[model samples]
Structure formats: structure tokens, C-alpha cells
Target: MRRVPRWALLSSGCAPVVLTGGWVVAGRLEGGSYDPATQTISVLAADGAAGAWVMTAALVALGLCHLVTAWALRPAALPGRVALGCGGVAALVVALFPAPSSGGSLQHGSVAAVGFALLAVWPVLAFDPDGRAPWGLRRVPCFAATAVMGAGAVWFLIEIQGHGAIGAAERFVTFVQSVWPFMVVASCVRHKRPAESRL
Candidate 1:
């Protein structure tokens, strides 16, 4: 029942904006040849890319935002909060270990995968068994959201294996992941209660 702090709201709300804006700006800077449908965001931040700094800065900011949001999200369960924080850490690690322009980096891919899994699973871990849970934190919605993210991950993996729309799939999944925290915060704010209740 703890109300989400104003800072949490602001941080959560900015996540999607920063992430999407970063990609847009990076893509434009990289020129028309950069196909968002195929090329992944990491490419923009890869070594020797025109917008590498921009994308890297954005990613670092995004990771910090997630960390702040996780810290402020007191209504969620402890395990969920821990997972969310760890996901944020993974994001930071991803930024630290950027992939090469021509090839991949095992460390980067592993960290990205960890980040994705943590973000996707945090919702279910945060779900409250009690009926008083906020709408967004309810089991049905949380599970559905997690499922969609998982499916997106699968699609991304499939695209990676072939010359498919990896960029589009990644953008969709990451966007969803970025925006979900805002939804949960809003729900907490809306259903603000007097006591700290399980969520």
C-alpha cells in the first residue's frame, strides 16, 4: 500500500522516452542506410559507429533510471525488486561491454539476455496473491505481460538466427519492458493505500 514516490513516477515515465528517443536519434545519425527493421540498437553503439556515444549515453541513463525506479518501487515484493535492480545492473553491464561493429561479444550478449530475463520475470515475481493488488500487478496482467515479453524474446532469437527483422523485434520487446514500470508505478499511485501491503 506504499505510494509510489514522485521521483519513481518521473524516472519510470522517462524510461521509454529515453530509450525510443535514443534509437531514433542514433538511427538518424547513422543515416538512411541504417535499417531499424534489421539492424539492432547495439549496432549504433558499436565501435566506430557515428552515434556510438549517443546510444551508449542513453543506455547508461536508461540503466540508471531502472535502478532508481527499482529502489523507489517499495510496494512490490522483495524478490521482484531485487530482480528489477539486478536487471538494471545487467543493463549497465551491457553498456560497459559494447559489441564490435563486425562481430558479437559473448559478454555483451550474455548480459543482455540476463537483463531481458530479469525484466520479463520481475512482473510475475512481483504479482500479489492477495486480491487487493493493483490492477497492473495482478497475476493475470503480470503473467500476460511476461508472456508477451517472452514471446518477443523468442521472436528476437529467431530473427537473430536468420536475416529477419531483429531490430524491430528487439525494439518492440525493449519498449514494452521499458514502459511496464511506468504502468506499475501509475497503478500503485492510483491505488495508494495507508499501509504497506503486498503487491
Candidate 2:
């Protein structure tokens, strides 16, 4: 039972909302083209420089989101904390990289890409009614979470081709890193029964 700071938890979830939201808004601004028709913002891409800053902000936002979501939901969560911690470390490693010496920069950008997968795995395995999950199911997500984070580590050490340890990804990697936050929100909703069960 780790004691989590309230600010840390709030910041974690809120950061992603702000960063990702900001990026989307920025896109809409440039094109004046938030398409209600397609329900997408920034139907067209922005400048490369703008895109880079948006992705960087997003990476930080998602990382903090994982930590915060965990804290907020820790009471009902299983052993998935290991996943959260390892995934966070993995994100730090990848994000810290000028990223990977050898391959395309995408391979080296671990923070958002790998981090998103790891965070998603947490809910897949550990979430349950009122945070009371079957022991086996709990283990499954934990392992998945660890594996996801570990994969990022591997990317850092081997795949990056031995360059500097920190870097950001191209857009694809950023998307990979960020997609899970939405899923996390969904999983929280899945706990609705549990929330009511307590009542």
C-alpha cells in the first residue's frame, strides 16, 4: 500500500488531457478544420516543428497519467503496480534517449509507444469488480505489464543500435504511447459496478 500524493495522482491524469487536448486544438487552429463530419481534429498535419513539440508534451502527459491513474485506482487494483512502475521507468529510458543509435527514430522512441502498451495491459489483467480480481487474472496482467515494459528496455539497449539513451518518436510512436490513456479511462468506467457495489 503505497501512499500517493494527491497532486501527483491528479497531475498524472490531467496532464495527458491537457497535453493531448492542446495538441489537437493546435491542429484545429492551423487548419480551422475540426471536422465534425469525420469527428477528427487536425485532418491535415501541422508543421514538423509543431508536431515535435506536441509529441513531446504528449509523452510527458501520458507518463504522468499512468502514475496518477494508478494512485487514483490503487485501492481496487491488483499487483499491476509493478507494471506501472516498470512501464514508467521504461518510458523514462526511452524518452531520455536521443533515442536508439541504429534504427529509425521510431524504434528508439520508447516512452509513449511502449509506455501506452504497458499501461493498457494493467487494466486488461488486474481490473476487477471492486478491485477484487481472481489471482490468476491478476498475474496475467502483471506479466503482460512487465513484458511490455521489458520490451521497451530491449528497444533501448539493443534496437536503438547503441546510440544515446533518450529520444522522442515520430508521430506513429507518439500515437502508440498515447492511445492507452483513453483505454484507461474506459477501464475506470468498467469499474462502475464495483463503484456501485460499494454503495
Candidate 3:
């Protein structure tokens, strides 16, 4: 089996950090009225908001990290890698099309939905059924992970329809999506063959 590279691990690990840090910093800079429970992260990057660049830069970095992780995950199936990379590109597109402060933009919502769906489904698509794959890439775990992400996405959509904590639901789904690559990379690194130690 091909081993995961150190750079992939680094990039994947940085994704959640960059996202959380960006939100915290943006929230701090914006001050007082920003409620994480009800508001979306994109609000931080909306037009005319203070510290918008912080969130924008974070989104760009997060997308690039996803692309890098996809490239580094050579052991996974090709279609899965393509889906992951395309998801990353969708994230970058989301950054490009920020929503307005008061309401959502159709383009931004479309790209964000695409990104969420791709990220949620990639794991299941990446799963190896041969039973020789790393722990994170195994069929059962991948299916479970995808199911959980799908549930979170449903909750987020319901929240968008004015049912519950929209910010919390979004954060839960996005944080999982951001962290999953790192888990997969770690599993690959842990199961590395003796001959592939250099990776």
C-alpha cells in the first residue's frame, strides 16, 4: 500500500485549526453582537463586515488544504480523490461568492451546498471494500461517517428552514468535514508498510 506523505498530514491537521481560529478571530474583531449559535461563518466574510479578510483567507486556505490532502491520498480510489478535490474547489468558489449581511446569495448557497454534499459523500466513495484498507478507509466506518455527515446536513437544512440552531448545526457538519481528512491521513500513516517508512 502507498503511504501518506507528511505534508498531507500537516495540511489536513491545519484545516480545522485554520477554520476555528479564523472564526474566533473574526468574531473577536467584529465584537459584541456576533452570535455563533444563530449566525453562519460566511457572515463573518460578508461584504462591509470588519475582519472579512480573515475569514476569506481562512476559507481559501481550507480549500487549498483539502486539495492538497486529496492529492496526497494516493492509496484511495481515483473517483474519491476527484470528488474531494472538486469539493475543495467548491469551497474556494464559496469564498469568491460571499453572501450579503442580511440575506443569502443564490450563487453562494449553491456552491456551499455542493461543497457540503461532496465533502459528506467523499468518504463513502473512498471506502475500500477489499478489507485490506486502513481503518479510516474501511467500508463500515466510511459508511457510518457519511451517514453522520448526511444527518448533520439534514439538520443544517432544517435549521435554515427555521427549526433550530443554524450556526451550531453548520459548525457541527463543517467541523467534521474539516477534521475527517486528518483522521484518514493518520490512519494511513499508522498503517504504513515498513518499506514505505520514508513517507
Candidate 4:
């Protein structure tokens, strides 16, 4: 098994924090005007929004973090790493093409959809063919993770169509996506420690 460097934890771990913190702070900046239950995170990054800059910066950081994590995750399959990296790139593009203040932007929605799909599927793609992989990267676990993320995405889409808790749905899915990398990295590190000690 290839060793996963300890520093991968930092990059993967920061993803959820940056995303959650960005939305929280941005929501606060929007003050009474923003309803997180009904509005999406992209709204916070939209043009003329009070905390657009903060949200944009957070998104950019998230993208970089994913890119770094993908590069460091040597144990995962190459296709999985590429998908994760592409997801990161999608995030950067979403940031660059911020949503419109009053309505949806085709470019923004398309990029975000692609990012979500990539993030959701990357876990299964990362599954180890052999049975010796870490817990998080194992076939069953990876499949479970992908299933949950896919369900979350469905919920998000349903919410969007119904004009329901769009923000809540988005946050739930994105949070799962952001934290999954950390779980995989942690498992790899823990699995490595035992082997190292034996050696």
C-alpha cells in the first residue's frame, strides 16, 4: 500500500470548516435579508451580496484544498484522484462565475452540478480493488458514502424544484462531500500506523 502523508489530514480537514464557516459568516452579513432555509450558498457569493467577497474567498480556498488533497492521496485510484481534482476545478469555476443576484445563472448552475456529481462519485471511484485498503477506501464503505451523497443531491434537487429548504439541502450534501476526504485520509493514516509499527 502506498503511504498517505500525515499532512493530507490538514488539507482534507479544512474543507468542511472553510465551507461551513464561509456560509455562516456570509449569512450573518446578509442579516435578516437572507433566509438560509430557502436560499442557496451561491446567493451569498452572488454579485452585490454583502459578503460576496468572503464567500468567494472561501470557495477558492476549498478548491485549492481539494486539489492538494487529491494530489496527496496516492493510495486512491488515478481516476478517482482526477475526478476529485476536476471537482476542485469546478469549484474554482463556480467561484469565478458567481450566480446572479436576483436569479439563477446557467453557467453557475452547470458548474455546481458538475462539482456535486464529481464529489459524490469520487468515493466509489477511489475504492481499492484489493481487500487490503483502509476502512474508508474499501468497496462497501465507498459505496455507502456515494449512496448517501447521491441521496443528498437528490434531496437538494427536490428542494430546488419545490422552492423548499434549498440552502439546507445544499449544505447537507456539500458538508458530506467536504468531510469524506478527511475520513478516507484518516483511515489510511491509521491503517498505516499499525504496519509501520510492525516494520
Candidate 5:
């Protein structure tokens, strides 16, 4: 019922924020392992398999969100939209790709990275806040710190709720990438709305 600006941004204006959130959460949902027994389809621990499903669903939703946002906008806004949407799609692709044995080599290729990229890009692309960049050393670093703290809070909330599926680092990433930005964007929408991206 609420015609929130957040909806406007996602459904029309800068859409990367929403897409990235979905993708990041999706990555967190993925569960995988190296199943040497089958010698096929890679393998991971039980939790990995479960996480994969969650991540997959989230990514699929994110992909759909990107598609909707991509087509909804005018041609004038295509470039930024493309960047944002591509980031989400790429995150999904990265997420679906098999992990290395050590799970170290391509960690940067994770969905969170794509989400982070989108968050970092949206303000500049949209210039949401009187057509100027929202992030400076101060605003961005403060927000980043807030995001880190928020993620820790989520980690604690998960423990309180007994929904412990993700590792601490993974939980932190989830909080920072998905929940934190989601909240920040909402705050921006409520008070600042979106601004034109600066040149």
C-alpha cells in the first residue's frame, strides 16, 4: 500500500541496490561440497548444499529483478542500468560457478563482490542527492563502518534466533552486503530520495 521511494528506485530509478541484495543473499544461501564419492557435480558439506539452494533462489530473484529494472527504464538511463544489472547477473554467474578446492582462489568472484560493486556504483550513476555523489571519504567510510556493525548485529541476531547456518565471516558479508545496504538505501529514499548521478 505504501508508495515508497524505495520502490521507485528499484522498479524505476537505480535498481542495482535491490538486485545486489537479492544476489548477495542468494550467495549466502548456497551450500556446496566436493562429493568425491560421485566424482561428479562437485561436492560440499551439508550446509554448503543448503546454502547453494538459498543462494540460487535469491540469485534467480535478483536476475528477474534486474531484467525488470533493465527493461523498465528509458534508453537515456541504460548505461547505469546496464552496469547495475550486469553486476547482478555476473554475481549470479559467479555464484553458480564451482568453487576451487580451497575455496580461496575465486572468493572475490563471489556474489557479495557484485553487490558491493553495485552499491558503490549506484550513487555515482544516479547521483542521488541533488545529482552529486553520496559517498566521500566521510560518508562512505561511515556507511561502510555502519554496515560492518550492522552485519555483526545480524550475526548476533541469527544466534539469538538460532538460525545458525552461515559461518561468522559469511554472516558478516551477508550483513554488510545485503541487509546494510538495504537499510541504507531505504533511509536515503525516505529522506533524500535519489539524485541525478554526477558527471
Candidate 6:
């Protein structure tokens, strides 16, 4: 297996922190006008929102982090890496096409859906065929990770349709997607072969 660069950990680890922190800070900036439980994070970045810039910046940073992580994750299959990188690009596009403050934007919604799908399926696509693959890249775990993300996506959609906790659902799924790359990097580092110990 090709070694995963040590710096991959930094990029992957920062993903979740940036995502969670972005929402929390942005929500606060929005004051009592925003109900996190009912509003999606995109609303925080929508036009005229109090913390639009902050959320937009966070989305950009998050996208860059994913792109960096994908580049450094040499141990994963090429298709998986490509998918991850594309997801990052999707994030960037979503930031560029922020939703309207008062209503939904088709472009923003489409880009976000694509990003979610890519992130959700990247785990399974990343599965290493080798029997000695790292725990995070093994077939079973990869499938499980994809399955969990898929289920989270479904829950988020249901919440969106029912006027439930859309923000909470989105946060849960996004956090899981962000943390997954970190977990994979950790597994790679922990199970590094002696020949690849330089990192």
C-alpha cells in the first residue's frame, strides 16, 4: 500500500472543526432570529444573512481541506480520491451559489445534493481490495460507513420535508462525512507498515 502523508491528518481533522465551528459562530451572529434546529446551515450563508460571509468562508475552507486530504490520501483507490476531490469542488460551487434569503435556489440545492451524494458514497468507493487493507478501507467497514451516511441523508431529507430539525440532521450528516476522512487517515497511520514508518 502506498503510504498516506502525515499532513493528511491535519486536513482531515480540520474538516469537522471548520464545519461545526462555522455553524455555531454563524448561528450566534444571526442572533435569536435563527433557530438552528429548524433552519439549515445554508440559510446562515444565504444572501442578507448576518453571518453570510463567515459561513461562506467556512465552506471554502472546508472544501480546500477536503481537496488537500484527497490529494494526500494515497493509500485509497484513485476513484475514491477523485470522488472526494469532486465533492470538495461541489462544496466550493455551493458557496458560490448561495441560496436566496427568503426562498430556495435551484442551483444551490442541486449543488448541495451532489456534494452530499459524493461524500456519502466516497467511503464505499474507497474500499481497498487487498485483504490486509487498513481497517477504515476494508470492504465491510467502508460499506457500513456508506450505509450510515445514506441513512443520514434520508433522515435529513425527511426532516426537510416535515419541517423538523433540518439543521440538526444536516449537522449530523456533515459531521460524520467530515470525520470519516480523519478516521481513515488515523487508521492508516496507526497500522503503517515498518517499511513506511518515516511518516
Report every candidate's CA lDDT: 0.88, 0.45, 0.89, 0.93, 0.42, 0.92
Worst 10 residues of 3 by lDDT: 190-199
Q: Assess the local accuracy of residue 93 in candidate 2 as a C-alpha lDDT between 0 and 100.
A: 52
Q: Local error of candidate 6 at 76, Å?
A: 0.5
Full-model lDDT, candidate 2: 0.45
In candidate 6, how many Å is residue 37 off?
0.9
User: In model 3, which regions exceed 4 Å deviation?
Assistant: 193-199
User: What lDDT is obtained when candidate 3 is compared to the true structure?
Assistant: 0.89
lDDT of 4 by residue, 23-123 (tens): 99999998999999899999999999999999999999899999999999999998889999899999999999999989779999999999999999999
Task: Give the top-scoring candidate (TM-score).
Answer: 4
TM-score preference between candidates 3 and 6, better one: 6
lDDT of 1: 0.88
* Candidate 3 TM-score versus the reference: 0.94
* TM-scores for every predicted model: 0.95, 0.45, 0.94, 0.97, 0.42, 0.96
> Model 4 lDDT vs. the true structure?
0.93
lDDT of 2 at 32: 47
Question: Model 2, 164: alpha-carbon shift in Å?
Answer: 30
In the range 16-43, model 5's lDDT, one tens digit per residue, is: 3443454344434442432222211122
State the displacement of the C-alpha of residue 148, model 2, in Å, after optimal TM-score superposition: 16
Question: Cα miss at 146, model 5 (Å)?
Answer: 13
Identify the superior model by TM-score, candidate 4 or candidate 6. Answer: 4
Superposed Cα deviation of residue 139, candidate 6 (Å): 0.9
**CA deviation > 4 Å runs, candidate 6:** 194-199
Cα lDDT, model 1, residue 2 = 70
RMSD of each: 2.8, 9.3, 2.4, 1.3, 10.2, 2.0
lDDT of 1 by residue, 1-199 (tens): 6767877889899989889999999999999879999999999889888998889988888888889999998888878888888888887888898989888899888999999999999999988887787887888988998999999999999999997999999999999999998899888888845364444
Candidate 6 matches the true fold with a TM-score of 0.96
Residue 118 error for model 1, in Å?
0.7
